[model samples]
Target: MAIHKLDIGEFDEIDYSLIAIHTSLEDYRLAYFINQKLHVNLNKSKKEIQITVKEGEAHFSRFHYYEMKKDVSWDLIQNKNEVIQQQNENNQSLFSNVNIEVATKVYMLPEFKKVDYFLKIENSENDLNIVKLQNTLNTIDNIATIYLVDTNKIKSKNNLIF
Candidate 1:
C-alpha cells in the first residue's frame, strides 16, 4: 500500500458556532430556560470538560442536546470553574507547614473572561439562525446578554475541543 498522510491543517478547519452568555443564574437554571425557550431538551452530560491549569485540574459542567431532525448538536457549557490550590505557609513564628487552600477562577475562553456560559452549535447543515436565537435568548428574564463569538479570535481554542 502507498503511504497516506493526512494534513494537520485539515483538522484545524473544524467548523462550529459559539455564543457567549452573560447571566447570574446557575448552570442548571440556565439550561432549564434554554430548554424551555428554545424547545430543545438539554440535559447534563455525564462527562465534564476538564482542563489542566497552573492551579490544578478544572472541570466545567456541560449540558448537551442533539436535534436529530436538524442535524445539529447543542452544548451549553459553563465558562468558568474554580480550582482550589493549596500553598504551604512558611512562617517562622507560627504555623510553618499550614496548607492554605485558595480558590482561583479559571475561564474556558480566557479571552472572554466576563462571559458566564457558552452555547456551542456544531454540525449544522447551514449557518444557524444566530440573530434570531440571540433575540429569543434575550427574552428570558434572567439572561443579561447573549451574543455571537468570533471563534477565529480566541487564543485558547484548544480548550473548546471538549
Candidate 2:
C-alpha cells in the first residue's frame, strides 16, 4: 500500500506585492495614468477575472503589463464590481411572475472594501523596487490614497491568485 499526499502550502508562495489604490478614475484612465507615470504599457486583458458569489457571477476588469527586461509582471485589477441578481417575484395578479434585477456590490478582496483598485507586482528576480513604485503611484493626482497591503494578513489570498 502507498499513500500520496500533496501539501498546498508548498505550492503557495506569496511572491507579489499588493498595492491598494483609492481612486475615482475609471479603469482605462487609471491604466493610462499608470503607464505615463510608471513607463509601462498596460493593456486590457481580453479575459476578465470572474468570481461566483451568492448574488451571482462578478466580473472584474484587469489590466496587465510585463517588463521582459526586468522579468516583472504588473496587474491592475478592479476591486469592486456590481453584480446584477435577478429575482422572481410571485404576485396574485395577472403578472404572477416578475423579474427584478438588483445590483449588489462584489469585492475581489472583501477585507479591502474601501480600495477601488489593486496593483499587483510580481517580481520574480527581486528586481522591482516596491517602495519607489508606491511613491510614484502616490504622485498621481487622481489617486486619493495609496498603500501596500499586508499579504500575510489577507483572509482571501486565494482570490488574488488569479
lDDT of 2 by residue, 60-158 (tens): 999999888888889999999999888898979877798988999999999999999999988754676778888999999889999899999999888
lDDT, residue 107, model 2: 99
Model 2 quality (TM-score): 0.90
Candidate 1 — worst ten consecutive residues by lDDT sum?
123-132
What's the lDDT for all of these models? 0.91, 0.91
Candidate 2 segments whose C-alpha is farther than 4 A from its true place: 1-8, 93-96
Q: Candidate 1 — which pairs collide?
A: none
Task: State every prediction's TM-score relative to the real structure.
Answer: 0.91, 0.90
Assess candidate 1 and give its lDDT.
0.91
In model 1, which runs have C-alpha deviations exceeding 4 angstroms? 1-7
Look at candidate 2 and give me any clashing residue pairs. Answer: none
State the lDDT of candidate 1 residue by residue for 68-109, as single tens digits: 887899999999899999888888857777899999999888
